[model samples]
Target: MAKLIKNSFSADLVRQAKFFKALSHPARLSILQYLAETKTCITGDIADELPLSRTTVNQHLKELKEVGLIVGTVEGVKTNYCLNTQAIKDFKSSAISFLEDLNIDTINCKK
Candidate 1:
């Protein structure tokens, strides 16, 4: 197997990649939107809010949690989930900065 070279990239780029990967899935985006709209920690079944199965939703939640975009606390039989505002803010800043740096309007590629 080829040696892993992810370490070659800057830390900010790696973190932004992780954030983008976590947001790539519609299920995960929906979960984030739901949490943001609710503005409160949810202890109930988040799966019910989406068309995906409970297991699938759980997987998406795990991805979000791994990216530090969501916070999950074990509450006995259930896990309470909430958005990590600080991380969200960081993601927003990074995404905006990265996109702004692209300056797409000035790209003169043939249409």
Candidate 2:
């Protein structure tokens, strides 16, 4: 596996990459969609709603939480997870800004 040279890129690039990577898996995407649809859900609730096992769902949840896409709160023996609205907003803005800065219209490469 190729190692990432963190010093070679801007911090924003790294951060954006992490955000995209967090959304890379289908399970992760599904988990996010489910969480968004239902304001908050417990681990068991998520497992029940999706086809994945509870263990697999938990792993996906861990990845989402790592990137601040979701937040989890422990209530007794269960963990309640919900979408992180501000983080989602920030990621959207970052993606939009990146695309806007691309200046694709000005590029004249022959297709």
Candidate 3:
């Protein structure tokens, strides 16, 4: 038989971690919250509301898009951006279940 890798984690676990990593930035979090609250696609002007520069905002948007958190479409010169609702909901549900399944009582620690 071929040799097996020692790490217990699977590729899916690594992918989930990467998705969370995309959310670790405060700017990206703000973008997600804005999209959720609006509940509709937005085009431009959002960058002005934040302290960051337009380029920085665009970069953050690109990062969020790369992780499948948000969807963007170009209409003429304007690029509309909105949250991927299903993705967001799935992430939230999975995260809740993951957190709920933790068996903290099973740990035996001396403190």
Candidate 4:
């Protein structure tokens, strides 16, 4: 286990690593896709939309919510979930900046 030293190189790297880690799973990606398409959905609707069992879908949704990718509102027996638009935009901007910072265009590969 790597120790995360606050305000250090490894910690900063790990922080950036988590942005991709959050979307690394197919189930989580599916949940995001569904939420993006549907605008908003109840827990039951998500269960019905995916092939996974309800329990599995619920678990995946919980993870998505924890990562700030989704927001959930409990309404009595139902839970309404929607994508956190600001979070999504931040992720997009951060990813774009990270890639641009790599400056891959300068690579020379002439054979």
lDDT per residue as tens, model 1, 19-46? 9999999889999999999989999789
Alpha carbon deviation, residue 76, candidate 4 (Å): 0.3
Q: Against the correct fold, how does model 3 do in TM-score? A: 0.83
TM-score of each: 0.90, 0.86, 0.83, 0.80
lDDT of each: 0.92, 0.86, 0.82, 0.80
RMSD of each: 4.2, 4.3, 3.7, 4.0
In the range 1-111, model 3's lDDT, one tens digit per residue, is 223335666554565677789899999999888888887889875797678999999999999899899999998988989899888887788667666667677889899
- Show where candidate 2 strays beyond 4 Å: 1-6, 40-44
Q: Report the lDDT tens digits of candidate 2 across residue range 1-111.
A: 234556877778889999999999999999888887877554545788899988898898899999999989888787878889999999999999988988899999988
Better of 1 and 4 by TM-score: 1
Clashes of each: 0, 0, 0, 0
Candidate with the greatest TM-score versus the true structure: 1
* Alpha-carbon lDDT of model 2: 0.86
Task: Give the lDDT of residue 65 in candidate 1.
Answer: 97
Q: Name the 10 consecutive residues with the lowest summed lDDT in model 2.
A: 1-10
Clashing pairs in 4: none
Please write out the lDDT profile of model 4 over residues 31-104, one tens digit for every residue: 89988887755454588888999999888888878778888988778888888999899888878877888898
Better-scoring candidate (lDDT), 1 or 2:
1
